[model samples]
Target chain A: MAKYYQPEFECMALEDMRALQSEKLVKQVKRVYENVKYYRDLMDAKGVTPDDIKSIDDIHKLPFLTKADLRDAYPYGLLGTDLKNCVRIQSTSGTTGRRVVAFYTQADVDMWEDCCARAVTAVGGTNEDVCQVAYGYGLFTGGPGLNGGSHKVGCLTLPMSSGNTERQIQFMRDLHATILCCTPSYAAYIGETLKEMGLTPDDIDLKAGIFGAEPWTEEMRRDIEKSLGIKAYDIYGLTETSGPGVSFECEEQTGMHINEDHFYAEIIDPETGEVLPEGSKGELVFTSLDKEGFPLLRYRTRDICVLSRKKCSCGRTLIKMSKPMGRSDDMLIIRGVNVFPSQIETVLIKEGYSPNYLIEVDRVKNNDTLDVSVELSPEQFSDTVKDLAIKEKALADAIKTMLGINPKVHLVAPKTITRSEGKAVRVIDKRKLHD
Target chain B: MSVKQISVFIENKKGELAAATRYLANHNINLRALSIADTQDFGILRIICDDPKATETVLREGGYISTVTDVLAAEIEDKPGSMAAILEVLAEAHVIVEYTYAFLAPDGHAYMIFRVDDNAVASAALAGAGIKTANQEDLF
Candidate 1:
């Protein structure tokens, strides 16, 4: 039937899971309160103390942490352990503001790898599998995290960090890699390259893929599956929460099962910060239950999704978080209307266009303008300007129907858009510069 | 009969068109007839070149979005009503012309290239009307 990395915790009873969370939450709260002055001040300002939280239910009394708090803390302001104890550090891309730096001790690294190993195992990895990690290495956590997890699973780990697509395929075939790990977009690029090389999924030995570090739609999942001839699985994590193994998809693939014993999750109304019940879509908040190095409590993750504890065939009782519909921070307010890049991506994939696109939003003379340049598929390209214009109008109309506002769709030549190896940059808001 | 025409995507940027032409000139390619259809964002530069396949390959290598398409080419009598007569034939055959560009051949004849909705149907109608059509060899 179904499989799990840690069958004990993955199938634990609800009462026992809650009791474990309560014990770890109490210990983690005291660790952050005593060691991290930055969060200690936040707790002090909110009139909260270690004694204030007795059980997991008392979590709301703790001060909430946001990206702003993380920015203020910067390099080491949030370290819950001594400097000598921490052995490693991971960082976010920091495209917005200051980069969030997270530290990990030896034990913390073990725990993080254990979580990731659970991901590999949940996807059916074993000693016989060859795990190739194509995520970027260095300070980025994706490569190292999955590499460590593959090692723990006793699989042949190929630490081939991102880029050099031809080389990636070469090694994948030469070594018969069984499990591929990287961002979903990169996996798609590899698949595209395979076709360019006059090869198909039959040429390689890829059985399953673990993709994360960016948002991907269900349509994309199916596209990658067809291109690679492998079951594509989505893994979820942020650098702030131990990289790519905070939650992972099992064979069932309905949603990702969050490792609640290591991290307790809560959903809250973004506007009021009031906790929502199960199945209510809201901003996700997480608490590090057993992290010793960079312990954070009530950290607000700007992802909008719902939690489901429905019975799954995967035999895991872990709470499932729906594929984040879209990040709250990713929402764009154009002409007084809310838009997400994922919305446009959904329309593009549905219209049989390549997902490679560029969105330009500008404010012209007090009115907002939306322009989307999408790459035309080779099969859809027309020599006549009128025929191409007709295709552009049809795509614009479809997007307008979905978004309630019209977008100026420009049909670009095939393969003109720049592809990405990590997270793809899909939106450019010139209106911000005007503001 | 159909003639090969090369279409290049010219982005609406300063000196982009200049760069494309310079690349073609550097490769010893000559343009026989050219027309540009432009918008606020981008323009499509359609050219009947002496070497259509070579021109497309050179422009593509130079990073220009270029493609070769077949267009119906008719050798008209370099006079006033002769052009109107060809249009009447196309209209009667229900073949719509998306765009047309013309240039005088060195042999003292007027050649008009018509990008029609259906190239095969347009070529058949022009043949049925006893018009002198230019094949790919005639283009060179």
Candidate 2:
């Protein structure tokens, strides 16, 4: 029964939240327009004058930023101010390409920790808790972001990078670590590994976990909680959005409350860039309020979701955004693996199989699983049918080794899969993974 | 008079070749004389080995449909006109050699494994050309 983490803001209304967003949005526009050249160019393209952006409604005049925008300006193109003024740098895993880097000044880093502290406090993490930051360290942001936040909340922080699973478990038991942070997928892996190793979560002192850096559903949350015997929460962020503190799930478990004090968020039609009404699903956009080194303006986050300014039960006067259902492109986030289904199709066709396939995503307990069904053409089917069961097992086994989750392979008749000549729906998620 | 030959299909893709070899490794089967005839999508892996049944089992286990076919093996000297001389005999006998691969025999002789248009006719032609045919025991 270790205790140190606590949720402070679980209930508050929409009016004061919008007021805070307006104040921050005003300061953010002035700061970014003066410092960041990228935002200036983007705004210029949209015919948006800095002064024209009078209110949060005028933010529609600015262009939306995207992962590609971040990628195109690889390494240092997105940097608003000088690297000298930047005190610390954090990045997302360059799983797709070069990692997105976010620079922070001493003040910016302090604000980030504050945001992280809000996350800590939202999840009820306190100073009496022994915090273990198990996100991979290095250029990746998840590690330092939570570490600093845990410290801010006055917790004893442990800077533990991921993959040393055995050592992490030992450290958890030895130090009586009550609070934890890491990617949701890796957390599930840890839970699975712990069970395989015959160690129960009660054997250690962990009571809560802050999982981010990858898209995870509420199903994974339930799975992590059951497997690790810990209360799991989702902390939303991107490297460009100040790591994991942009928003977080409060005690209500409805959605994450956007800490409008530090960031102004919007939901826009991803195609037209038109600002959508709150609660309408669209691409998420962000503009940092007090960020100094790299404040983005109207950055399109590709995360297709909705936002609300309703008061939460946690008493926080901030906007809350729904968990993203999917992305604009083929960003199928299977158990935190961000990959296009086309990539898997390419792999299958390269293996001399037909391109026709169906992806079934489901949850086993609290964890998510993927199953891929591929069809072999008639002639090849007979030759392969003798080995069909074997082929099915082998392909599933191979994909599991590659994608980190065992995707069951089903061999069906050609044209059995519903194929459209238009946009293909490659993934069929059958799991109650998202709340 | 008779030699063991197995047929395998390989896909044309980057690292697919290595993937196939890894599958073979998983089954612990060894490759002997191998010849590949490739099209754009797939290639046939013509192989001769000591354990054809075991190789077939492993290939099936690895999710590849494979088959065992009988072919001809002839002992030829490692000298000039060795290939031309043997083909000349086949051409005269009106036997077509579709594809071929070779291995050194245990008795300081080189054995050529051939898939012909007609195995029976080709075997008679090779024997008529004074070429001694090989047995499975001669494989090692």
Candidate 3:
């Protein structure tokens, strides 16, 4: 039987959940309009007021908060409550632009932890399990969020922030950790380490793994699952939305269940800001329904995905979101074709290649050139240059089939491609089209 | 008999081959024979060193991808037809030679290293033809 951290909310009736969201959305808008002057001015500029946001249905009237808005506001412009009430702050890695720092009050932290706890429970975690959080602890939301969630689920938590792979495996073996939480890439690395140490999945006690924070393919999920002998679950969240507990995968592994009571999600046409209907592939927008310290209404997430209200077997009524295709900022337009790094990754893993790849997009003579440098593993290494060339050509053909654009594949030595401890830097756009 | 030859993957960039050779020299590892097969993007540096195991370890520690493969090292006369005679025996035995490199041994003898598709057939054919082949310890 499926267990739940908060059954009342997770299994709430559809109508009751919508009613609850409407109630929370109305109160949240009023609070943000009154306390946050940055958003208040945006609302004023849009000629909308608290009275215009009567319920969740009227959310369209509110102004959208984007990364640019956050950058414009900087440190404290988006704070819905006084600084004295704020307890902690988590921040983005800021690889794209300026870092986005999100603040939280005591209540806000508790709410976020509750959402994470629900995610843990959905993954069959309980007090009997030993949960190891390998996500980076400080600044990054991945570690702290899952750490708190494990604590809330009454599990003996190991706050083993990323790296130190040997020690991670040591503790995992010594303590018989049952659940693992970290980015998908880190989990894959750990699995690789386990094999290198001559240890199999049977040597460890891990039963479930929650992997996210970066885009991963179904091929990668299967690879990790087989490597670790654990049912890998995908957890989705961003620091902009109070870390990684916003939505989490259930046993079904189809999509993640969003904590709709705390976060109201909408799919928007990224180009025109028009709200896309359910199941439409578009950019995702979120609203913190009850956050006090930093309450953002209609915050543009820039994650492209679809929202589905289709009935889930896990018995959670919270809407489900497909794994994000790719962040809008991470999408690369090469040779006038929309290409995502994740698409390239899917092809690489499917072709029995390591996910550690570097994509260099360059412009030469008014033409876009896609060059992929993939690390050749020991198993794939050939003594003859002809065989290696054939492998490279085959990989290039496979990528071309997937992307509809020819790519020059370079087979590099193993470990030549940098392994990421955090989010991996996969793409280097040398085109400089912005200039 | 066959000897272990370490093949290191080296990118075809300026100074990459020097860097790899320098890594071995820094470790005081001596190479008996070496050959490089290059493409536009990368090259495979195949070497017969005093200690194949140590050479592989040092190269790996230096962040070079390498693997050890068994290659037949047949002692051949310095005459022009000597190398062809060894290949003719293997060709008659239907054993294809993938690549070959010759080096002068310390004893003033020439030896040809043959990477073949079937090592067992090539080794047997060389033995049937009364050709002398070097083993792993014979080179050092």
Best by lDDT: 3
DockQ of each: 0.17, 0.05, 0.44
TM-score of only chain B in every candidate structure? 0.92, 0.90, 0.97
Docking quality tier of candidate 1?
Answer: incorrect
lDDT per residue as tens, model 3, B19-105: 889889999999999999999899999999878888888877887888899999999986778877998999999998889998988
lDDT of 3 by residue, A1-435 (tens): 339999999999989998999999888888888898999899899999898777789988888998888888888889889899999998864322356789999999999999889988988999999999999899888899999999999999999998899999999999999999988778888998999999999999999999877666687789889999999999988778798889999989999999999999999998999998999999999999999988888999888899999999988889999988756677675543447787788889989999999999885533468999999987788789989999999999988877667999999877878878998989998866432
Model 1, B47-96: lDDT tens per residue? 88777777777776776666788888899886679889999999998999
For candidate 3, the TM-score of chain A alone relative to the native chain A = 0.78
C-alpha lDDT of residue A427 in model 2:
80
Pairs of residues at least 3 apart in sequence or in different chains that clash in candidate 1: none
Candidate 1, position A397, lDDT: 91
- Candidate 1 retains true contacts at a fraction of 0.19
Give the per-residue lDDT digits (tens) of candidate 2, residues A1-435. 212122232233455555656667777777677776776787788777778867666666767777778878777776767889998887654233534677888888988888888788766777788999998777667788898899988889999888789888888889999988988877888888889889888787888899986777666679899889988988888778788788888777888878776778888787887788878998888888678877877777778888987766656656789888767665666655555576567668766788888888775644567778786653453222234456666777666655555676766544556878897767887764444
Instruction: Point out the worst 10-residue segment of candidate 3 chain B by lDDT.
Output: B78-87
